[model samples]
Target: MNGTSFDGLTVVTVLYRSAGMLAETLPTWVRSAGDLPVRFVFADNWPADGCADVVAAHLPADRYAHLPDDGNPGFAAGCNRAVETVGTSHVLLLNPDVWLPDDALARICAAAAEDPDTPIAVGLAMHGGEYVGIDLNPVSLFIDRPAAVARAPLGPSGGAAVLPTALYRRFGGFCEHLFAWGEDADLAFRLYAAGLRTRGLDLVLPHAGGHSVDGDDRLQGFRAFLLARNRLLVAARTFTWPLLLVAVPVLALAHVALAARRVRQGLLRPFLRGVGRGLVEGPGARRQWTGRRFGFGSLLRYLTVRRA
Candidate 1:
């Protein structure tokens, strides 16, 4: 790890039947990273469509590597696997659906150089004109939302986030068991507990929003279950017992609010099943993230205001 090197950055993006979008966005991403010594890594979650071809067509052979993983291992797993191939001091997790600003990614790397303690630097996300920033509120990311970190003090945009590769690995990357939705929360909460702040940069990233799973019939209602399941899993994995006691009621209400949306989508069954799965699986996951907690009492004070 080139701990002090601002010149190196690894842009990790996990692909899921995203070749078309990858092709569309690749040029801008490359241009935005101009002369920045960025290692572009694409982890293919759905390889049948040849995301490799898109990368090969757009980038020089030495600039990128393709990690083929099938079985649709889920976003959390893909992100973790992709991060493994990183050689840079800082890692930026880019989603295929997002259209990066020509300067945003580079500026984020520069910010990393300026403020080494933040570890994580996030670009604000705008999905269809909405400003969604990094929300550290464990409960905030769980609810289907588009709120900003400043506004909500709660929701996070996992897609356009940048962090040092060391802290990411030290906290144990994304919780692979989360498989999808709340993994970002799982990691964010853990980092917050470890006394790290995720700074939101002053850049707006445009998102094409849910390109992979939005219309996929196979994953219908799957995100809902994962969101619900990971909500509890995150609580166990990152919350101190005291935090859990105070958080349970707030988290339960958040679940109920999300449940109403799932019900409307006719996903009540899977949603409920996920809650049960979370209860069954949380304790095992707890062992992986418990050592990082500083104190929930301090965390409560830090919850609403994380210095940007």
Candidate 2:
């Protein structure tokens, strides 16, 4: 709210057993938050990592606050929960593993505030100590490297994006149904549907991927499920019912094609099973498959909420 300048910006982050990283990240913010009001809020979904004490010990009383809850709620819920407590003009939903240089967070806030009509601004996510730029189609985030960053249309990155709390609330935060994987796409779709703009900023923030979710457990399969479910939800809400009907065949064939490819690689069983589960359980099932949930309801609202 510093009139497009870096003044009072609050940082919100959701933690699911990622406290160790917080110890390293919070100090960086504390040292560089400047005169700006930056709240390093931590929402402990389960507190399995003793995050409360970890954050409390490092984060100053005036600068950080811990949300009261436990439940290991999914990332979307955790982010929404964090947004509720933010009273600042801007909110940056950050990840614990994200290592911000002293002034990077402040700069992103400043960049976002430059336009009063700014709805959302995203920063580049760096991994393995390099800078990663953003692109929308097929979604890309550049990593590692000290160089110039560029702003462009990008598929949303949940980490380190600055957004006005008003727009965020109006959009109803993230669709809780997504749980994880597709929430970014779902949110991006809503922002686009509602006639708002989202910009990707040229700045690098380090991200340690999979530090929280174990890779060997076939977490990607769960990601695939959410992606499949939410992608259908987006199509159902955004397209006319008839158009959605037509699109289904195309999408189904694509799924089959992908499944066939995966099968050839000996990885189709879980992917196919997840896809089947996604079809039976999401808003898509009622609308595209039967038009049940679509009967006498706003398509957008109806599709936005629901277990998928």
lDDT of each: 0.73, 0.61
Question: Residue 27 deviation, candidate 2, in Å?
Answer: 2.5
For model 2, residues 211-249, the per-residue Cα lDDT tens digits are 676554566556555555555565555444565576667
User: Which parts of model 2 are misplaced by more than 4 Å?
Assistant: 1-7, 126-151, 215-220, 240-246, 260-267, 284-308
Candidate 1 overall Cα lDDT vs. reference?
A: 0.73
**lDDT tens digits, residue span 1-308, model 1:** 33455547888998997999988888889889788878899889889998898899878999998998888788888888888878888788888987877987678777887865455545544545554444444444343233443433232456877777777787778888888777876776666665565555666666787888777655777876777788788888877788777777887787788788878888888889888898898789788765765356646566555454
Worst 10 residues of 1 by lDDT: 146-155
Candidate 2 colliding pairs, count? 13
Model 2 residue 156 lDDT?
A: 47
> Residue 268 of model 2: what lDDT?
70
